[model samples]
Target: MTQQPVDDIEIVAALFQLARSGAIYTKEVLLIEAKKLFPDVPEERLLDCRRQLGERLKGSDYLGYSDEYDRQRRRKAS
Candidate 1:
């Protein structure tokens, strides 16, 4: 069985659906879910799709990290 290549639009749509589910998710969690949905897709490609989606949704109320998660990320960065 051959798996059809998933396109950027499809990836973006899947990510959007997961994001807009009223549940806030950290980047890691979102990426994990995306990977599960697109196991055949490369992680790099998934990351790129996620980046684009985030850029498009910036300043909107669609997908966002919680304040606590943001703080934790910052701490990890330091």
Candidate 2:
């Protein structure tokens, strides 16, 4: 059986939703939520999606997952 392709937009939306909720979250938490949205998608693909989101959203209002702590949070106003 072939796995369906994961939607990058949806994954990014979920990540953004989680990050913008005024709370800190670990990468694990973000993955868990994404998995819930795309249960059949491979874990590797989801991780890649998360990585891409981090890179694209870097320095934006939403802070992506960090390797140093594996946590995500919203950027504060300057």
Candidate 3:
């Protein structure tokens, strides 16, 4: 069987899928894995991806998923 070629889009999708499935959790952990997969990506861009993925995974039961904490933090920062 031919293996699918890995790319940035596929990698990001897999990361998000894992989070959605409750396999991988925590935005920090996801960002770390993303950096490992695409070390050349800019830090700011990675953070943006992290934020976007986090938003998409909202309400998931993934380990470390925490909308409440995020909201509380945002309220405190406001």
Candidate 4:
């Protein structure tokens, strides 16, 4: 059986939803699932998507997964 092809937007959306729903926690787990959806996707692309999502989802009532990247930024700014 062939796996369905997923686009970047779809992958990002899935990751966002999963994070918000508490289905995915760390970046490691997110990549594992993202690869399942789009096997040919590169890790760099997924990392980029994760960065974008963290920016978009920060401080917008998303209490599911804390943005560790933003936390690091705060730690550095202090």
Candidate 1: pairs in clash: none
Report lDDT per candidate. 0.85, 0.72, 0.69, 0.76
Task: Give the per-residue lDDT digits (tens) of candidate 4, residues 23-43.
Answer: 877978987887776668888
TM-scores, in order shown?
A: 0.69, 0.58, 0.49, 0.61
TM-score of 1: 0.69
Model 2 C-alpha lDDT per residue in residues 1-78, reported as the tens digit of each score: 986665787777777787778563788888888788788878998898888787767645354335323332233322
Off by over 4 Å in 4: 1-7, 59-78
Which order, best to worst by lDDT?
Answer: 1, 4, 2, 3
lDDT of 2 at 65: 34
> What is every candidate's alpha-carbon RMSD to the true fold?
5.5, 8.3, 6.0, 4.8
Order of candidate numbers by TM-score, starting with the best: 1, 4, 2, 3
Candidate with better TM-score, 1 vs 4: 1
Candidate 4, residue 58: how far the Cα is off, in Å = 1.5
Which tens-of-lDDT digit does each residue in 1-78 have in candidate 1?
987887899999999999889574788889999999999899999999999898777645445555556779899999
State each candidate's clash count: 0, 0, 0, 0
Instruction: Please give the RMSD of candidate 2 to the true structure.
Output: 8.3
